[model samples]
Target: MIRGVLALIPDEFRRFTPRYLALVVLLALSQAAAYLLSVPVLQALFDGNYGDAWRWTSWLAVAVAATAVFGYLQSMVGLRIGVGMLRSVQTRLGDHLSTLPLGWFGTTGSGAISRIIVGNVREILGVFSHLLSPVLNAVLVPIVVAVGILFVDWRVSVAMLISLPLLLVVNRLANVGYSRSNQRIHDAASEANSRVVEFAQAQPVLRAFGATGAGNKALDGALRRQQKASTDAVFASVPGLMVFALCVHAVFLLLVYVVIGRATGGDLSIASAIALIAVSSRFIEPLNQAAQLSNALRSAGSAAQRINTFLAERELAEATAPVQLSEPSIVFDDVAFGYSEDEPLITGASFEVSAGTTTAIVGPSGSGKTTLLRLASRYYDVDSGSISVGGHDVRQQPSETLLGQVSLVFQDVYLFNQTIEENVRLGRPDATADEVRRAGEMARVDEIVERLPDGWATVVGEGGASLSGGERQRISIARALLKDAPIVLLDEATSALDPHSEAVVVRGIHELTRDKTVVVVAHRLSTIAHADQILFVDAGRIVERGTHDELLEQGGRYAAFWGERSRATGWHLAPSTYRSDLNGALGG
Candidate 1:
C-alpha cells in the first residue's frame, strides 16, 4: 500500500514522503510502546511497588504524549502531500488531456476518464491521511508490540512472536479475492457509468425507436453486470473474514493459556503475568483493524493501478524546435491514415490549398471528406506521409503555432451554457464588446438575440439546445469570425437549416472566408461551383480534382456525382415537410 501511494506521488512532492513515513513509524512505535508499558504499571501495583508504579506511570504519560505529537505531525505532513498531489494530478491530467489525439476520446469514452480523474484520484488522495496510516500501523504496531514484550515476560512474548506470522499468513489467505474483485468492480462500474451517460444523451433517438426503460438492452446489460460484480465482491469477502476471525480468536485463547501456565509454574511473576494477559487483549485490536482494512487496501491498490494506466496514455508529440508560421497555405503530401493500422482510411492522398484560395472537398457520406479537413488541422498525425502549413512540416511546428493560423467551424456546433456574447467572446476572450457585436452582425446572430428577452445576456442552455440548429450554426460562425484567423476549415457550415437561414449562414461563411485560405467539406454541390479547386473523394481516395466546370467537362466521377445531385433537386416534398430551397442540403 505504501509502495502504491509513493508511486502515484509526483516527483516534486517526493521529498515530503520520507518525513511522513518517519513520523508514522514514530507514531506506531509510540502507540505500541505505550500499550506494552501498561504491563509494567500493572506488575508494579500487583507487587505493591507503589514508588516504581508512579515512575512507570510518568513514563507511560510520555509515551501517550509522544504518540499524540507524532500522530499530529504525521497528519499535518500528509495533508500537505495530499494537497500538492491533488493540484499536480488535476493540472497534469488537464494539460495531458488537451494534447491527446481527438480520436482517443471517441474510443476511450468520457465515463472511464471521469472515473479515473474523479473517483480513482480521490481514493489515491485518501491513502496518505486514512489508508496509509492505518495499514502501516497495522504492520508496525504488532511487530513493535511483540518484540517489546520480550523484556517483560519471555514465555508470553515468545507465544506472541510465534502467532504474529501465523496470523499474518491467515489474513493474507483471506484477502486473496480482494484485489481481483475490486478490479472487476472497477470495470463493471465504468461500463455502467458510460451506459448511464449514453442512455441520457441518446434519449431522443432511443425514445424515437421506442427503446426507453427496459427496452434498452445495452444499458440493461451494463447495469446487470454492475449488480453481479457488487454481489460477487460481497460473497468473495465472507469466507476470508470468517477464517481470519477464527484464527484471531484461537490466537487470543492461546495467549491466555500460555500466560496462565507460566504464572502457575512460577517461571513468570504474578504481576508480569497479569500485565501480559492485559496487553494480549490490546494486541487483538490492531490485528482486527488490519484484517478489516484488507479490503480498503486492495481497493486503493486497484485505484492506483487504474490511475497509472490512464497517465501512461501517449499524447501527440510536439516538435522539439518549432518553426513560426510564414504563410496561410495547407498541403498534404502522399498521406495515409487509419483509425487502425491494418485498415487504411485515406491512402496516398495529396493536395494543396494555396494562400488566398478556396478549395472544396466534395464526396459521398463516409467517404473521408471530414478527414481531409481534420488532417489539414492536424487533429491526428498521418500514419505515413506528411502534412504542412505555411511551407513547414506540421510536426515541425508547435501546436499553438499551427492552430493559431487556422480556424474551425464544423457541422456540429457546441456552445457552453452562457450568454450569447460570452459564447462569441470564446473565440477572442480579450475582444471588446464592439468587436464581438461586429462579428455577431456579420454572422447574422444579431437576428437571434433581437427577440430574446435577455438579448446579449440570454443564456444558451447546454450545447445551445434551447436554440434552433441554424441559430447555433450562426453563433458558431460568429465565434469563428471573431477569431478571424487567416486560414479557415468549414465542414458543411450551412447544413440542416431552412432555406432562408441557410442563405444567411452562407453569407456569413462568405464573410468568414473572404481573402482567407479556406478548405471546406462542402455538402451543396451547386453552391461550390465557383470554388477555385474541387477534390472528389470516394472510398478513401481523391479520385477527381478540378474546378466545378472543369470536372463537368471531363464528365467522369465528379460529373456523374453532380448529375446525380442535379437530378435529386427535381424531387419535391410537401411545403410543411420542407421548402424546395433545401435542394443543396437534400441533394448533398
Candidate 2:
C-alpha cells in the first residue's frame, strides 16, 4: 500500500518522502522511550529511593517533550508532501490524458473516463492526509516498543515480539478476496454513473419514442449491481476483520499472562508488572488503529492501480521532425486499418482527392464511410499503407499541425454551453465580430438568430438543447465557415433535415467549401450526382470509382445502388380514400 501511494506521487514530490518517513520513525522511537521511562520511575519510587526516582522522573519528562517535538515536525513534512502530491498527480494525469490516442476515449465510454478522472483521482488525494503516516506508524511503533521493552523485561518482550509477525500473517489472511470485491464495486459504480448521465442526456429521444421509463431501466440495473457489489464487499470483509481482531486479543492475553506469572513467582516486582501492562497496551494500540483503517488503505491501492493502468496506455506516436503542408489534398495509398487487427473494416483501399476538389464516399450502412474520414484525420493509425494530407504523410507531421488543417462538420453537432457568438468563436478565437456575423450570414444562422429572443447573444444551453436540430446544425456550419481551414470533411450533413433547412445548409456547404479540399460521405443523390469523383465502398473494399455518368455507363455496383435509391425517392403515401369512397357511392 505504501508503494502504491509512492508510485502515484510525482518524482519531484518524492524527494521529501524519505525525510517525512524518517521523522515519523524518530517520533515513534521517542514515544516508545517515554513509555519505557515510566517503568524505571515507578520501580524506583516503590523501592523508596527518593533520589533515583527523581532522576528517572526528569528523564521521562525529556523523552515526552522530544516525542512532542518530533511529532510536530513529522506532520508538517507530511502536509507539505501531501499537498504537493495532490497538485502534481492531478497535473500529471491531465498532461498524460492529452497525449493519449483520441480513439481511446471512444472505446472507453464516458462513464469509465469519469470514474478515472473524478472518482479514482479523488481516491489518490486521500493517501497523504488520510492513509500514509498512520499506516506507517502502525507498522513501525510496534517494532520500536518491542525493542525498548527488551531492556526492561526480556521475558515479556519476547512474547510481544512473537505477536508482531503473527498479527501481520493474520491480517493478510483476513483481507482475502477484498481486492476483487473492491474492484467489482468500482466497476459497478462507474457503470451506474454512465447510465445516469445517459439517462439525463437522452431525455428527448427517449420521450419521443415513449420510452422515458424504459431508458431508466439501464440506470436502475446499474444501480442495483452497484448496491449488490457494496453488500458483497461488506460480507467478504467481515471474516477477515473478525479473525484479525481475535488474533490481537489473544496476543494481549498472552502478554498479560506472562507478566502475572513472573510477578507471582517472585521473579518480578509488583510495580514492574503494573508498568508492563501499560507498555503492553501501547504495543497493541497502534496495531488496532491501523487495523481499523485497512479498508481505506485497500481503497487507495485500488485507485492507484486504475490510474497507473490508464497512464500506461499507448499514445499516438508523433514525428521527431514534424513536416508542414502547403496543399490541402488527401490521399489513401492501399490503406488497411481496424480497431483490432484481425477484423479489418477497411483493407487495401486507395483513393485521392486533389486540392480544391470534392470526393464523395458512398457505401451501404456500416461499410466504413465514416471510418475513412476518421483515418484521414488520424483518429487511428492505419494497420498498413499510408494516409497523406497536403503531400505529407500524416505520421510525419505533428498531431496539432495535421488537425489544424481539417474542418469537420458531421451530422451529430456539439455546442458548448455558451452564448451563440461564443460557440462560433471557438472556430477561430481571434476572429472579429464582423467576420463571425458574415460566416453566420453565409450559413443561414442569421435567420435562427433573428427569431430567438437573445439573438446572437443567446445562450445555447448544454449541447444546444434549447434549440431545434436544424438550428444547431446551422450553428455548427457557421462555426466551420468561421474556421476556414484548407480541408473540409462532411458526414452527410443534410441527410436528416427538412427540405428548406437542407437547402439552406447546402448553400452553407457551398460557402464553406469554396476553393477548399472536401471529402464527404453522401447518401443523398443530390450531393453524390454532382461530386467530382465517387468511390463506391462495399464489404471492406472500394469496388468502383468514377463520375456519376461514368458509373451509370458501367452498370456496376454504383449503378445498381443508384437505381435502388431512385425507386425509394419516387414512392409516396397514397391519397386519403374516405371522402372519395362516400362521394362515389352517392353518385355525386
Q: Give RMSD to native, each candidate.
A: 4.2, 3.2
TM-score for predicted model 2 compared with the true structure: 0.93
Candidate 1 global TM-score: 0.93
Candidate 2 residue-wise lDDT, 496-543, digit = tens:
789898889889888888998999998789889999999999877999
State every prediction's TM-score relative to the real structure. 0.93, 0.93
Q: Residue 559 CA error for candidate 2 (Å)? A: 1.7
lDDT string for model 1 (52-106, tens) is: 9999999999999999999999999988888887878877777788888887887
Question: Residue pairs in steric clash, candidate 1?
Answer: none
